[model samples]
Target: MSIVERMKNLSEKECPVDILRKEIAGSKCSDCGKCVFGYEGVTQLQMMLGDITEKKGKGTDLALMKELCALMKTQSLCEDGEDVADAVSYALAHHAQEFEAHVAKKGCAAGVCKKFMTYHILAENCTGCGDCLDACEEDAIAGKKRFIHVIDQKECIQCGACMDACDEDAIVRAGAVKPRCPKKPVPCKRK
Candidate 1:
C-alpha cells in the first residue's frame, strides 16, 4: 500500500513521521534530477525526515515541509514526485500532532523510532545465562553467572542483538515509559 494509505489505516504501533521517512528512503522518486522541484524537494524532505526521526527536528520543520510539498505537487516533472508530495501532504494534514511530538522532543507514542526507544532487561524473565552479555558489543549488559543482568542505559546503543541472543527472552524494548529494573546486577529469581 502507499504511504498515504498506510497513514489512513494507521495502527497503534505505527508512527506517521517514521513511516513517511522510510517510504521516502525506499522510493526511487528522488533518483531523477530532471527538475529541481522533484529532486531537491525530495532530497530536503529526506534530510528533514531523517532529522525528525532522530529527534533533531526543529519547531519550523513542519512549515518548511508543507511549503516544499506544495511546490512539488505543482511543479514536479513526473508523477513519482507528485505522489510523494501528496503522501507527505496527507500526513502533515492528518498527523500534524505526531510531527509536533517529535519536533518538541516528546517521546514517540508508537515507539517505532530507535532514538526514542530504550532497551531493558526484564528481571522476572532473565535467567542470567550470560548470552546477552556476550552478544553485546557495547558491553552494555553487566552481570555474571546466575545473576540478573542489568542494562546501562547510557552505555546501551539500543541494538537488538542482545534481545536476539537471549534465549530466555529477558530483554525488551521500552518506549515512553520504562520498566522498573535494578540499577545494578542482582541475584536471579528465576532458576
Candidate 2:
C-alpha cells in the first residue's frame, strides 16, 4: 500500500479531549466561573486542566472528571463534544489504574503525560515472573527467568502495561526524572 493510502486523516484520528483542550487553550478564558458549574465535558476538562495548571491540585479529583464526562456523553449536543466524553469514559473503564496513580501518587503510567509519572520495578518484590516483560510493548523491562527484572528508563514509555501485568505489585513510580510541566499557578488572571 502507498503511504498516502496508509496515512489516516488527522481530523478522523484526533482525540476528542485533545480537540477540546486545544480550543480551550487557544482562547483567552474570561474565567467567568461558569465552567466550574457547567455541564459540558470539554469545558469541565478545560476547567480542570486550568485548575491543575494553577497548582490548585484539582487534577487529583478523578471522580469529577468521570462525572463530567458522563454528563457530556449523555447530554452533549454534538458528536464532537460527545467524543470527548466517550474518550474519558473509555479511559476510566480501560485505564482506571492510570487514573488511580494520578490521583494517589500524582503519577501517570504513560509517561506521555508531563510530570505525571516515571515507572520503576522494585527488585525486592519482583519474582521474575516475566509478566511485566510480556506486558511491556516497549521492551522496557529487562531480566532473565528466576531473577529480578529491571526497567530501562530511557526506553520506557510509561504505558503501565507492566504494572498491570505484575502480580507481585513490584512496580512503582519513582517520580519524574525531568518534569514535563511545572506545577505552578496559571500565568493568567481569572475574573
Candidate 3:
C-alpha cells in the first residue's frame, strides 16, 4: 500500500489513457512488467502538479498546504492523490508547533509567542505606572503608589499591551519576535 505502488495500480485501472500517453511522451513511462498504464516518477508528478497549479493560479498557499495535510491525516486514499493532500493538511494543522521548534524554538501559545517579550516589572524605572495596570486584561500587573510594576508570567498573555502602555520603555519582548506565519525560514528542514 505504499503510495508509489498504489499510484501505479490506480493509473493502470482508473487513470485516463491520454494522460498515460502524455506521460510516455515525457519519456517518464514506467516499463515495469506489471505496469499496465505507464506512470511518471513521483517527483516528476510533483513538479507537474506545481506547473499546473501555477497555470490555474492556485499557487502555493501555506494555509492550503496545511488544510491538505490535515485532510490527508484522516484520508482513506494511500496513493499520490491521497498522500499529497495529507502532507498539506498536517503541515497547516501544526504549522505553529513546527515553526516554533524551527529556527526560533519559541512558542506563543499563551499569547506570548515572541522572544522579544517577557514577563517583568520595572522597579525604579516604573513610576508605579498604572497605564499598564489599567491595560492589563488579566490583572497580572499589580502596584500602588511607588510599588514597581510586576508581570505575572503565569498569566501575562504576552500581548505586548504592557509594552505599548509603558512610556518609560520598561516593557520588552522576551526573545526574537517573528510573524505568526513565517515564510523566510522555509518549511522543509534543509536550510
Candidate 4:
C-alpha cells in the first residue's frame, strides 16, 4: 500500500514515524539527482526520519521536515518525489502528536521502534536455563543454573536475541512502562 494509505489505516501496533522512516528509506526518490528537490529534499527527509526513529530527533526537526516536504511537492522533477512529499505531509498533519512524542523521547506507543523498547525477563516465566545469556552477544543477561535472569538495561541493545532464544518465553519487550523484574539475578520462583 502507499504510505498515505498505510498512515490512514495505522493499526495499534504500527508507529507512524517509524513507518514513514521505513518508506522513505526504501523509496527510489533519493536515487534520482535530476532535481534538487527530488534528491536533496528526500535525502534530508530520510536522515531526519531515521533520527526520529532512533530517538535522536531535534526539537526543530518537525518544522524543517514540513518545509522540505512542501518544497519537494512543488519543485520535484518527478512524480516519485511529489508522492513521497504528500505522504510525509499527510503524516505530519494527521499524526503530529506521535512525532512530537518521539522527539520528546517519551516512547513509541506501538512499541515498534527498537530504540524506545526495553527488554525484561519475566520472573514468573524464566527457567534460568542460561539460554538467554548464551544468546546475548552484549552479555546483557545475568543468571545462573537455577536463578531467574535479569536484563541489564544499560548494556542491552534491545536486539531481542534473548527473547528469541528463550524456550519458556521469559523475555519480553516493554515500551514506556517496564515490568517489575529484579535488577539483578534472583532465585527462580518457578520449579
Candidate 5:
C-alpha cells in the first residue's frame, strides 16, 4: 500500500472519535532496536517514524538509511530485520539510480514519497479548468480561468492533491528540490 493509503486507513480506523482522545499505548515497542546487530538501521527507522508521526516537513535521510541498510545486511541477528536489509541491499545494488535520485534530487521515481515530489502544471496539457486551484490547500497554485496554471514551488507542500484533481493530465512532477526550484534553470560555472 502507498504511504497515503496507509495513513488514511490509520486515521480512519484508529481515530474515529476526535472529541475526546486519550493516549493509548497499544503496541509494546520495547524501544530496544536490537534486531540488527548495529544501531544504525534501527536508529534511522526510529527517526523516520518520529518524523512521520510529527508531520515533519523534511525528507528522510537517504544516505543514512542506505548506510544502515548496508550495515544491517551483515550485522542483523535474525530474519526479522534481515529480510528488509536484503531488500535494501538488492535495491542499492540494482536500483542505485532510484536511491541516488531520492538522496541527490529529493525525488522518488516511484512517486510514493510525497516529501520529495513537486507538482508542476504543463501549459500545453492544462485546460485551466481551475480544478487544481480548488484542490490545493496551500494556495500554491495560481492562474486565471482558461489560462495555464503555475505551481509556486516554495509554497507547495507536496500533498499531491492538485495532481489528483487534474483530469487533463497537466500536473507533473519536477522532483522537489529544496532551497532551489527545479523548474528554474541554473547556469553552470566552471571552476
Candidate 6:
C-alpha cells in the first residue's frame, strides 16, 4: 500500500483517542475543582450510573466506571457534567496508577507534578516583581500590593512554568530533585 494509504489506515484503526485535551491523558480526575464536581457532580448516583452506563457502551464498563466515579465525587466538582468528562475518560482508560503517580494532595496541593512544582520563592526574598506570574503555567503566583508574590498552593502545577520566567532568582526548587517519572502518563499535572 502507498504511504498515504498506510497513514489513513492507521488513523482509522486507531482506538478512540481524545483530540482536544480537556483533561489529562491517563488520569481524567485531576482533583481540579472542575472534575471534583463535573464528572460526578451534585446529582443522584442513579443518574451518574446511567450516564456512566451509556458512556461505557462505547468502551468503558459502566459499573466499573461508576466505582471510580464515586471515588472522584469525594473531592467536589466544578458542577458541569460534560465540562469535565474527558478526565473521567482518562481515569477510565488509565486507572488509579496515574492518580498515585500524579495527584497526591500532600506535596502537590496545587495539582502539579513534583517535577514541575520544584521551585518556590520565600516572600521576604521577593523583589516585588511580576515576572514570575508570566512564567507560571499553573498561575500559582499572586502578587501583593507591594509587588510581593505568593504561590496559590491549590492552583499550582509544578511544570517549572515560573522559574524560567523569573529574573530576580526568587523561585528555586530548594535543591531537591523530584523523582523523575519515566513515561508515566502526563495525565494532567495540576491547575
lDDT of 1: 0.88
lDDT of 5 at 67: 73
CA RMSD per model (angstroms): 2.1, 17.0, 18.5, 1.7, 12.4, 15.3
Kindly list the per-residue Cα lDDT of model 1 for residues 116-150, writing each as its tens digit: 88899999999889999999999988999989999
Tell me the lDDT of model 1 at 33: 86
Cα lDDT tens digits for candidate 5, 56-143: 4144454565577667667776553554445444434554554455445445544445566567776657666789999999988877
TM-score of 4: 0.91
The prediction achieving the highest TM-score against the true structure is 4
> What lDDT tens digits, residue by residue, belong to model 6 across residues 75-165?
5443234323434444435433322323222232222233423456655456656678777766677764345566665677656767777
Clash counts per candidate, in order, are: 0, 4, 21, 0, 0, 14
TM-scores, each model vs. reference: 0.88, 0.39, 0.37, 0.91, 0.50, 0.31
Residues 26-75 of candidate 3 have per-residue lDDT tens digits of 33223332222223233333443333222221334334444434443454
Question: What global local distance difference test value does model 2 have?
Answer: 0.55
Tens digits of lDDT, candidate 2, 1-191: 21111222224433223333454444322233344222344555767654442223344566788787777666655554455555556655655664455445455443434344567776557666778989999977777666667777788876788888888887876544542321221222211
lDDT of 4 at 28: 73
- TM-score for candidate 3: 0.37
Stretches of model 3 off by over 4 angstroms after superposition: 1-117, 176-191
Q: With candidate 6 superimposed using the best TM-score fit, by how many Å does residue 142's alpha carbon deviate from the native?
A: 0.7
lDDT measured at residue 52 in model 2 versus the true structure, 0 to 100: 41
Q: Which stretches of candidate 4 lie over 4 Å from their true place?
A: none
